[model samples]
Target: MRAVSLVPSLSEAVARTAPGVLVGVTDWCTHPAALDAVRVGGTKNPRVELIASLAPDLVIANEEENRAPDLQALRAAGAEVLVTEVRDVPQAFRELARVLDACGVRARPRWLDEAEETWAALPVPDDRLRAVVPIWRRPWMVLGRDTFAGDVLARLGVTPVHADHPDRYPRVPLEELRECGAELVVLPDEPYRFTADDGPEAFPGLPCALVSGRHLTWYGPSLGEAPRVLGRALRAARR
Candidate 1:
């Protein structure tokens, strides 16, 4: 079955598990580095005309990563859209299974098994650290309540300071975050491209952990390596 993936992680999942199934993907779907699919467009603003012209049997998207109107337009154009809502690791595994099933893949992908095993074998730190994880910087947005990143951090013994906030991705003031009493500052490298030189300066005295946004936020083959990759970064955090 030919498929078009709007989400990067989903693109990687399909490409890695069933190579020839994907006939189209967004320009942002950079995984499998040598992926040869047609680049439709960006996640938010995909070229619907180009996608419909591909005549794909299925299109995969995420509720958070894709816009509703785009999905509606695909449906309106008689395209079958499989929308996934993956809020945590378990949910990601389940959702991936569903997507693979739809793709006619009967065997479970090895990366999925490895990812689940990796997280399962990890020992949660006994001493939890309160951290403020910022995703974007212009207006200063952060990982708030019910997000997959928050759940990943919690399992690793780092609690999001704004986990109870009303919005999942809330835009809190810089000063408000600095004074939030968090023991550490977790910065991911996407959505805003935070670096050791760029993000750490914002939280003067707190230990700053510069993490890979893909591991911290994405759900796919990267999950297998996320625990180890993120753990090392978190452990090497400096004040």
Candidate 2:
């Protein structure tokens, strides 16, 4: 079946598992490097008319990454849109299976198995550290309650300071984040593109773990290496 993927992680997952099935993808779906598909535009502001013109059998989207009006429009245009909501690792895996099954992939991909085994083999950290993870810097949005990134870090023994907050992604001032009493500040390279030179200084005395956002947030082939990659960054964090 011809599919159009709006989510970057899901796009990569499908491309890795079964190539040539994707007829369209969002501009941000930059995986497999040489993917041959029509650019449907950004995740949030996808080109509905262009996507509809492609005549895909399935359109893959995420509740967070896509807008409701767009999904509604696709369905109204007689397109089968599969909306996925993955709040954590298990949910990600389940959704991946569902999407792949919908795409007619008969067997589970090796990367999926390796990703599960990688996380399964990980030892839960005994020395847990309280961390404030900032995703963006302008409004200073941070990972709050029930986030996939927070879950990934929690597995590695890091607790988010605002994990109890009502908002999944909370807007907190930079000063308040510094004063939150977190032992370390975990900074990701995407959304805000925080670097060792840029993000660490905001916290003054606190240790800063500069991590790959793909490893922390994207739930796909990257999951196979995320544990090891994020583990090293978390361990190597320094003041």
Candidate 3:
């Protein structure tokens, strides 16, 4: 295994799995800070030429990272590629296992099991187990069904409420949420980092908080410890 590349989650999983191999990662790839940045590329439009030149034994990609065309090109070039698509905890463990096996590394992360156990022991909130995660605000888009964000809430004993609209990333309407009766509305801190002053009153009927988008949604090596952090937050919110 000469090298690896990352686009989804963090390279920490890859680096920890393959400590000795050279890794080609994106400027956005923060998990493995020690990885070679020379072959760095964008999340979707990765430098194909740079990647091909690396002649890596394996290139790890995910549905969320590279586009179909980009992945097709790498495969067409005869590169050995492994795809990780972990939307929830169980899937996350399975993906980690594959990446670990490919990288020839061992030592399961302590956070993995801890996150699950902590989640199971969390006190169920008396508030409505429903939430609204606004991914964008100007046009007002929200996490819809079957998404990573939606699934995270489901695992946390919460329901993700999405307005029925056309686009997958639809410009959701506040009026639509009137019926959800979600006690808590979660606003992410990326792509549109919002604040209480930004307009929690817009949905004045609900209790809201600005949450880290990565922890609530991003499932990766970070998820190992990230879940515990989230568990505490959920408990606090419940209180």
Clashes of 2: 0
- Candidate 2 lDDT (Cα, 0 to 1): 0.92
Off by over 4 Å in 1: none
lDDT of 3 by residue, 32-146 (tens): 5556545558768888778888888888888776687888888888888787786656676677677766777666666556655665665665544777777877677887755
Candidate 1 versus truth, CA RMSD in Å, comes to 1.0
**Backbone clashes, candidate 3:** 0
What TM-score, over all chains together, does every model reach? 0.98, 0.98, 0.81
Supply the global lDDT for candidate 1. 0.92
Worst 10 residues of 1 by lDDT: 230-239
Q: Which pairs in model 1 have colliding backbones?
A: none
Write out the backbone clash pairs for model 3: none
Sequence-dependent TM-score of model 2 = 0.98
Q: Write the per-residue lDDT of candidate 1 for residues 39-147, one digit (tens) a residue.
A: 9999999889999999999999999999999999999988999999999888988998999889889998787888888888878679999999999998899999999
Cα lDDT tens digits, model 2, 86-179, are 8988888899999999999999998998898888888878889999999998889999998889999999999999999999999999889989
- In model 2, the worst 10-residue window by lDDT is 230-239
